[model samples]
Target: MQTIANTTSDFIRVSSEIGTLRRLLIHSPDRGLGKVVPSKAQDWLFEDIVNLDMMRRDEYDFYVKLLLYFLDPDKIKGRVANLAPGTDRGFFKPDHPDYFASEKVIDIQCLLSDILADEVIRTKLIAAICGIERTSFKTQQQLTSVDPVELAKILISGSLPDRTMLFAPLPNFIFTRDIGIVINDHILLNKPAKQARTREALLAQYIFFNHSLFADYRDKIIEIPDNEHAFLLPDSDTARDLSRSTLEGGDVMMIGPRHLLIGCSERTTLYAAQQVMRLVFDKGVVDTVTIIKIPKKRDYMHIDTVFTQVKRNVWVLLGTLARTGDEARKQDVMHFFAPKDLSEDLKILQFRKGQEQKPIEIENLEDLLANISRNDLGATEPVTFIYSGNNEFPFGAREQWTDSCNLLALKDGVVVGYDRNDYTAEAFRQAGFDVVTAAEVLDRFERGESSPEAIENTFIMLPSAELSRARGGSHCMSLPLLREGF
Candidate 1:
């Protein structure tokens, strides 16, 4: 709604998982959580009903504090300046105060205010919601009479003037990662699998389109079409039918500059993965896409939930999924291919619907890496995999269910995750990462006792007793916009 000149300077630039984080977009749990009743928790895509007050008091506030400390612009610049001689700290000043403000972190509520600030944006948004045209004077008057700030809150909290209209609160909106993803210099707006989450995606879409910070990147936003509308479209009459495709950001990962890894699991469909690959390639965004098909189950709802990169070539994976055929029980399969590899023959042979496609013939994680290297480069990069719970059985399963492997990388080797997963924390400690609590890091930061340069390969652990009840971790809550390239 905010019409500003598009510029490349405002675009997102994320290419790898371990890059130094610059800007992040997050949504704190709000009144939406109050609507999630015990009788309708599953309908809202929650594993169980949660206590809204406890979630806000014990979980979200602490998580925001940790994120603010790690992403502080001054600290990030200091770290870069320390690492690279002659680097200018002034160059690291972010475009928006929300990104650099140490005392204030930007939340969805703040974003909505920006969206409604512009008269044109407000009118268009209102028209879209009411299924009317912006040209209507009566509608314009009605929109103008409502205070922008109050309207923004009402829209987000789902407190419609007419209570008869069915409105479901977006409880899962706290998990920002599932709404959208930023690839190298581009934004991919996701179409969620559940209807309750569609509004979340729409809000994100509006924010990206109208937000002043993202004005220049408007053309770069790619909207994934909703699959439910497939029946409305005429049959493609082609070999590939992507109409019914669906993609969630939680299942898509940008592992490296030239490569993207997508999960065809419980939430993302194989058709959607193929479509994303084609779109990225056609736009010259990425060179290759690797599809990892994990078993369709709630536990393995997303790839990030089970695996994430910790360093340049090091990763953390769920113990069970990292194993081979006999040990893994056919739960994990890695599918790799390039844009050029897609042909009518290849499509018909590999991606035919309703038939179980042969899994990528790899014995284990090592074999999968070998395959990736063979196709993407001449030699395989040495990869060190630290499994959750040190590959120990019952403990591993237990910790993983609590999001032990769902770590968010702040820099090359530094990451953040749940403190409740003691086994995974112990594993990170044994791996030489300084396992520290969020309180310790925040205290040092507030007291000026430490800087980003003082901490390397450190895992800042946050209290997750209440947050984990939502079935997500740090990776699920934060969506990175910009990060320093490797």
Candidate 2:
């Protein structure tokens, strides 16, 4: 557990999604999760109340340990024999005295604390957060007196050390991928659509702008201007609000050095997508930008949830949205009688910097994925698709609900995903990828029987009973700050 004084500026590039991961951001589940009561769960964007203890100790603990092994091995390599994680609280908790504070396997809470150590930043942040929470002047004064580490915890969990509630909990902080994304070397911060996520974006903005770890690239940060009255409008029931420019990191992907993908889904609107596309093009960051528009349903909130890269030529996605018009409609006899459900259809349009009017419309999801691999990546192998739940009846929708398609690729063809999605795991196996449990892999690494370098084209399964309740997968949980370019 080492603290980061500064991460080299050159270590902040992410030109491809499936490149080897060297550094990233993640958050450990906090006590705020335990406070989500059924009455306020929907308002807070949580599907259901989760057992906080189980989610932390049994499920998320594995994710932390697994990441430590892959990115910062020395921190936990020899500690496996002595660390009784079940009984130890300090090892994983960022606020605890015995926490493993690795620089490479960075935690957002730690970065928050680091910046708060400065009196100027601490005062400014207190005012900003207090304004958003609408806290009383007395409460803001009291917060100014708290320690940086404690204050970071309180700001995120919305609880004091005495278990007193101060404001609404930022439960979605665990989904770090929604805050901001690094494209090439520039950082495009997120503008959240839902009021529930407003604080998350605010905190991220402060950290990226003020933190010395990212000081070298501060001038390159891009922000979208919201609608003049967007703040006053109550959460919209419809998905694409053109007047407002709302964007999340989950909708933005750095597919290749010369290409970027932005989704016009529930969280991101076409206005924001166009704004970002023009910004990147003017900056000469990338030459191609593709926007994939899907239904605004809560089930498919972002493009990453529908599909993510497994390898240069491999993709796992939901078949319902990837199929052609004829394939999407089942039973030709009944097709004539039933009106097509326009809501389930997917639309993809690609734009080049100088040729905006001649945008090319892609027919299906598979075609867009294959083009990225063959043309953008120059892959010699044939492109392949592994459908969610093996593209079977009932399973495709059922497993997608549990995040079978949302996976984080540790490296090309090596990924981390939930083990609960049995059908998706079988699909990975059929695609010639070996599926193994994270616990077993950890044991093997500890005993020196296997290593991260030796693993390839494999699915490292993680425990997901309680994590699934959050309705996000590893892809949503991670913010890759640095990755090797293919």
Candidate 3:
């Protein structure tokens, strides 16, 4: 890992969703993404197999450039003008000497490499990974001899330097948010619900515990313990569902210093949600924990896919999924009298730390988010919402599927999103926010026409032609480690 001499403070806390993000964890698209075959795409949580080169050069590189410009301007300010726009990917590669190795924007692969350099950690991690992948002992032995940098790449990409595959690639590792979440200076590691993501959890746990950067906050790391007799549980669906203690970072949000929101979606089980509520409450990390349960379906994989905070009082979401009761069920003349789909119902329950006897029930997503803005963050302005695809028919659902609701806030009113969500961008423009493309923003920054501090209430759009196919947005790509508190 690279160091920043100017970075002195050891900050690692998140109080609000829309705070100015100073540090985050990200993984650039590696060879593993290109290995995701169509046969196992859905099994690995990908909507479709992506054109890896396009995803790297055309789409995700813009995201990296945008983040660097806003968070660590010195690393990319004037240098971008010299590189070939679409073809120069070496600037983003961590191992490449020319790569923008910003300490502020840390990459997980580099952290893995840093830890793997230790002989003991390397042995233990290799054993652990082999145990999980069931690779032959010879394969494990072969990995131990590889250089730390190459080993780290192979571990994540699951491919050797010569393109030999020893095990399945961790394609979903790009979505760093699923591995763990930081809540008020405490890291809450995830217990993933899916089997395909087991390696990701293991790697993240090792990084948090073994990395020098996280050494200061080791005691603050909160890991969800599996349910009693969880190991002995049968393989049947009913049996596993009864005690599966799974929680994903996507379903978690440290919305306020004293408030945490968890969603019980397809990726996060309610068993894990209840466990987190008790855990955070007992730790005194938060006074309140809210569980927002949405339909357990692929379309709404996590709460973030449905809504994310843009500002203290402003939020963007899929209105189709945020409404409740009659409002959610659109009433046309023919379907007015038909039975409502109970599965679409959105449920909310709030648990106070010491007041567990009287849990509060919130009616719907809008009311819950609005309450957080007012009560938790002390926003006095009227809570406003920008809907997916401008809340139009079919477009809302279409855009939401492409992660229109998923956005990462750079500061209070500025966020990063995909350029493909044209209607959502228009909605932001309509709402009096400046919407600019990532390439254009970088150009402006390079020309000294714009700077991060002066940029406010702006939507920094990224090229996402290939990224959208991976079924994640910028929010999913980032794991905020430190942010300015509200």
Of the candidates shown, which would achieve the greatest TM-score relative to the real structure? 3
Model 1 spans with C-alpha error above 4 angstroms: 1-11, 73-105, 130-144, 160-166, 226-229, 232-243, 324-363, 369-382
For each candidate, what TM-score against the reference? 0.78, 0.94, 0.95
Q: Rate the local accuracy (lDDT) of all candidates.
A: 0.68, 0.86, 0.85
Per-residue lDDT for 1-486 in model 2, tens only? 234667475868999999999899999898888878899998889999998887887778778888888899998886665334355422468866667778878889998998899999999999999998999999999999998888999999999989899998989999999999999999999998889999999899999998888888898898887667666666662333847899998899999999999999888999899989989999999999999999887988999998999998999998778763445444331354225543246899999989978999998888899999999888889999998888766677778889998999988998989988999999999999999988788888999998889888999888888999999999999999889888
* Candidate number achieving the greatest lDDT relative to the actual structure: 2
Residues 1-486 of candidate 3: C-alpha lDDT, one tens digit per residue: 453222455568888888889899999999999889889888887878998888888778888888888788887776775334567644466887778988888889988998888999999999999999999999999999999889999999889988888888888888999899999989999988888889999999999998878878899999997788777767785354677888888899999989999999887888888888888888889999998988877888999999999999999998766663344334421154225543256888898988887989987778988999999999999998898888765577789989899999999999999988989989999988999988787788878898888888899888888899988888999999988898
Q: What lDDT is obtained when candidate 3 is compared to the true structure?
A: 0.85
What residue pairs clash in candidate 1, if any at all? 7-216
Q: Write the per-residue lDDT of candidate 1 for residues 1-486, one digit (tens) a residue.
A: 112222446437888777888777777776667667778888888877777666665556556656666666453332322112122222211223433333223566667766787788887776665442123556446656676666665566665455321356777887888888999988998878776676676678788887877777788888765466667777772123445677888898876777787887678887788778767877878865677777666877888888887777567877666552233322221122222211111111122122224423344544554444344333345656777776665666678888887888888788889889888888888888889877677667656788665778788887777788889888988888878875
Clashing pairs in 3: none
Ranked candidates (lDDT, high to low): 2, 3, 1
